[model samples]
Target: MKQKISLITTGGTIASKETKNGMLSSGALSGDELAALCKLPDDIEIRIVDFMKVPSMHMNFHRMLALRDAINKELEDPDVTGVVVTHGTDSLEETAYFLDIVTEDKRPIVVTGSQRSPQEVGTDVYSNLRNSIYAAANPLLENGGVVVVFNERIYSAKYVKKVHASNLQGFESFGYGYLGIIDNDVVSIYQKPLHREFFSVQNEIPRVDIIKCHTGADGLFIDASVAVGAKGIILEGVGRGQVTPQMVSSIQKALDSGTNIVITTSAEEGKVHPAYDYEGSAFDLKERGVILGADYDSKKARIKLAVLLACKNKIKSSDFKY
Candidate 1:
């Protein structure tokens, strides 16, 4: 009764190569090619599925929905013990968490990417790919939701973030560390992220944007987003969800126009708080109908907002709990 691991390849640094100008995720390395370089154990079967050939930076909400659909389709096969996605590191955390929110089956779905291109000296691609498959195959992770694997650490997608720009060590789970670590092809489990509700991937993807607060920031971006028909916006306010006084009116206008807002802080470690009393403080924003981003960074907040908005058909738009 041998089981298989569905290896889905979505182009990223793991499949990139060097060019005359610079490095690009040309996707020359398919899943089969990349897996061929790995010294896989004979106990598990690996099945390659080439889904897309685009860099991670090019990923969007629509593609994420499509990716979720593809993974869900594979889960229909009982023989598929687990799944691995080779992606680019740029937006790997976002994609991982989005899938985490939408995937319901709970069998381990692990995403991995390399900081350096596959052609680089000492590229981390091989180890990342191998570990991803190992993590996916491990029965202990059968219900672990979605996670990112790199540098031997297993990070829950909800808590993970890219900590370094160009390090082989791609991400960290912030205050939560990692769910577990894998050593010598062995995975040890200690804990899992605080579980959140998993929404079914919806039929249509919507426009959700993140607007960062800067000095003298006007609410112009919010106005612009609303003007362009954005379904939701994640306001990355200055520390503790504080925005300038000038931006409050813009935020209000967007809210009045029926655009949902989630307030997030620039600080990395804490949840958005309504501590200050100023015009654009989280307190003020909440009073004006903005949702507080609980421990979610701007990117993650945006992802959640999109999911809730996209699945509005089944989940009443007004009854969005998160």
Candidate 2:
């Protein structure tokens, strides 16, 4: 039986081209153009849908909701075995995480994009697009949640990180490593994410921001964020999620003011532990009622916070399942 895959194009470097003025212009290619860039098996059917033409940096909450709607609509069709979304790398992780948290269906939703533009030499678009299709088509990927395939590495949507500037293998999932990889036309599974659930957006755009703590960094940013009425804040603390004295006081104040504060480690991998020497900054902040962000990076943490804030009234800490 032939497997049908819907290739949803949200413009990124993969679909961008250099204009006469040498500026990178996006959405220059149609779905048919992208379909022709890859080689596929005869038993696999491909359909393309252009969801947006903006770069990943331009991606926001509203666009994410629209993409979710598109995927949900396609999932309704029995023939659509899987979905592939080509998005810009800048915000690929954010979009992937959003989909993983919101969408309930297990049908493989693989998001991928090229590090190098299609016009550049040794572009990775063809292979990434090909492997994403394979990953999406494989039945093993079912119920695995959102998966991102780029530069021969497959990452769990919730754990993946874009660490490098312009490298082909830029996407990585720090301590957890990759969930699996696609090799020899085979999609193999190594590990599964510990948590998974479906969250509802409900059209509310919640404001969540991240505050990175460094030496001599005052609480000005934190105050500004709160002043602008941020519902949630993710504090990217030092190693093992430690903040300075000043920042700690700011976080404590934020929490006291009824704002949700999630503390996450700036380390590439590992979850935040409140047990490590709480006598100083760590202990003070923990006492102030800040929630630990676990292993989520600042970017993913922001998305998780935003999604949670959107469902704030309808969800509680225990019911805050994601």
Candidate 3:
């Protein structure tokens, strides 16, 4: 019998078309329409599910939860072997990480998106979609958790990032490196992420904001974030997560005022080292009870924080294991 794969569509550049006004119009194609372009083997049974038809830049926490629900529904079917998500590249990494953290299933949940539109001469939608389907059908991918396969590279959901602006090979893993690669129909394996089951929110939603630190930056943004009733904030600081003196004061004030703060590096790779000079900005901020975001980027860090905060009332800080 052929292996069964479910293709869930969440609009991105792959499903967008160029309009007369020279702008990209999304939802130009349906799930079945894109699936028709792929050439599949006889041993593969592919099914299309149209989940969302908006650009990934417009995707939010609620939409992510919807996608999770869709995946869970499909997984409940005994015949489904794996799942593939067609997403926009803008926030693809963030959604992938969210799924990796919240999803309990061990089946492969692969996310793919195209950098170029289907109307382009060298559009990569066909190849990317084909490869995504192929990856989904492979048995070895079952235990890998959530991953993003693009530009012929396979990256873990938590570490994959969109680095290039318009290149076909825009996604790459940062510091920890990719889990493995797909070469000549073979899915090789390397490092696997630690399987930590984090709880998801069942009730209220949490709002998170990202604050970047640059030279001569002040506490204005932080003050405004707190005033706006933000539940949590992610600080994208310079190397090793160092912020300006003014921003440091703002972070401390925010923590003092009952807001949660997560510190992550603005750099592409490496973890945030809080052991650096205690007199510096990072140390001062850490002393105020700010949580270390480790190697998570600002976007992923924000998502993680939002999910945690949603369940804050039920799960205590000690139960908060990320």
- All candidates: TM-score: 0.94, 0.94, 0.93
Candidate 2 ranges beyond 4 A from true positions: 276-280, 314-322
lDDT of model 3, residue 159: 73
lDDT of 3 at 32: 80
Q: List the RMSD of every prediction in angstroms.
A: 2.2, 2.0, 2.1
How are the candidates ranked when ordered by lDDT, highest leading? 1, 2, 3
User: What lDDT score is found at residue 216 in candidate 3?
Assistant: 88
Clashes of each: 0, 0, 0
Q: Rate the local accuracy (lDDT) of all candidates.
A: 0.83, 0.82, 0.81
User: Residue 184's C-alpha lDDT in candidate 2?
Assistant: 69
Please give the lDDT score at residue 256 for candidate 3. 81
Candidate 3 local lDDT, 176-209, one digit each (tens):
7777777765677677777655556686667789
| Candidate 1 local lDDT, 1-322, one digit each (tens) | 6668998999987887678788574566777777777676567788889899888889987888789889989999988989999888889999999999898986889999888776788988878887888899988887778989998999988879998999887698777789888888788989865555688754576888999899988978888899999988988987778888999888888888788888888887877777888778889988888887867889988888888887773323233333
Q: Candidate 2: RMSD over Cα atoms?
A: 2.0
Which number leads on lDDT?
A: 1
TM-score for model 1? 0.94
Q: How does model 3 fare in lDDT?
A: 0.81
Q: Which residue runs of candidate 3 sit more than 4 Å off their true CA positions?
A: 278-280, 313-322
